[model samples]
Target: MKADLKQIQSPIKSEMAEFELRFKDLMKSRVKLLDHIMNYIVRRKGKQMRPMFVFLSAGVCGDINDSTYRGAALIELLHTATLVHDDVVDDANYRRGFFSVNALWKNKIAVLVGDFLLSRGLLLSIDNDDFHLLKIVSNAVKEMAEGELLQIAKARKLDITEEVYYKIIRQKTASLMASCCSVGASSTASSPEIIEKMREFGEKVGMAFQIKDDLFDYGEEEIGKPVGIDIKEKKMTLPLIFALQKADWLEKRKIIHLIRNKSENKKAVNEVISFVKQSGGLEYAKEVMNRFYDEAMTILQDFPDSEYKESLSSLVTYSIQRKK
Candidate 1:
């Protein structure tokens, strides 16, 4: 469960350093206010996992190129934009342990910053005629929006079935990862066959990744995300959904009532957490998550072995094993 994340980057260190410069250059603006906001974004960036996915996928299938850097930048740009707007929507004050764009600049400026970042990503692709990469990322953006909307629509009811849960996670979480892999392959001028295969690989890994995140809600782990925050938000994640499936008719009713009305109550959230653990929800979710991880490994195993493949395989393991 312990990966030297620095070792994970060793294979692509030079490319990553180059990408840092590209990412910063891509975020620059002439407007003073926007420049200030973008500067803050540069200062408080996360682990850059999406870019790693892009580079690793490229290394596996073909050579890394300028387009690969741009592909990674596009994912980061879109992801940062989404976080900015999501903070506005959630009325959140922090992101990745730093003050959010909304917290510093307020909702209006935060929203506009999100818009600007999004447009910059799109224009970068269109201007370069990187149409194939653009198509992949654009579709992901569409799916992510629909996924959030679907989750919001379902939140009031707490009615996410296993099928619906898969749909939500696939769009909300998996789409971007899938696009990262596809864009990586496309950057190297990979064949359509190879690109499609990488997309599937990324999607499955992303699904498992989200499930592991949901499992954290029932644990004592202190991730950046608060324990039970999903439940508090009325988001029906896999662990809870699976737990409810195992409940008897009356137990199910009690759980639903608590989720709908007592979600804000810490004691009630703990009760729900205890219920989920005792009902075997966590075990069931881990099982499904491993299945996805193994499937992704199988696809990767078919590829030739190299430093790149080893690093990518390690990433698949780290996704499920990460503490936060």
Candidate 2:
């Protein structure tokens, strides 16, 4: 049975709080201006999913160790670092419905703050002397950067395939999640078999998370993000990839032309959504999400019953049904 997100709060809650406090404390040493921007980014907040995964997986495997808390904090720091750089790359003025650090503090400051966060995370990782954990997180950081670069380099290419889209999502989203789970299991020096299982669970859940988030772009106003951002940015997500497969030559040509011109404004976005609907892209995407969520839960069944396991399972289910 699928778990409820409501029941999955305990392990993640404390760890998330710890990460927030550490982030604040680490940034306190910055100069006034840099400190202000760092504070703003912190205040915007997030679901803290990466840290939550770290905490919950550790709990599910056994008990919370000091490494667990520090690892969780490190993941959040790494995540924040990426968001800061991402704002610069996307030229995004807003995120989480607030002004981005790049918008308020300028790109250079934002980039520097991001670097500081990364450095802080690395410093903290060294305190634990866990080179293995560092390696896992470092790989995530590298993959995320490469993923962003891959997307930018391939932006607006009509020839972009579903395989390519999945590749990017795995790097940009799944890799960190895999690392988070691996670190959790590693804290216990768990068996390689157990570690691999946890990694698979996280990767599948992370992919589901991104795909569900992408669907928000086309959802009704009451249900999701403002539609058209991806189209405007020329980022081809799963829906678009599915639509490409199903659309006829004429329709495909039209979409390819619009993507090439980067002409998908609000109205064009609406038309694309409609076209995707008619082409059954949304259905295909939803089907894929459900399948992945199911697979993630299947992996969790290997673990004996526990509240942490229940919560992790619930998180997977929630990823599909989340409105925002």
For this target, which candidate reaches the highest lDDT against the unseen true structure?
1
> lDDT tens string, model 1, 37-104?
99999999888889999999999999999999989998899888998999999999998889999998
Specify the highest-TM-score model's number. Answer: 1
Candidate 2, lDDT over the whole model: 0.81
TM-score of each: 0.98, 0.93
274-314, model 2: which lDDT tens digit per residue? 88888888888889888888898888998989878878777
Q: What local lDDT does model 1 show for residue 261?
A: 95
Model 1 weakest 10-residue run by lDDT: 216-225
Model 2 residue 89 CA deviation in Å: 1.1
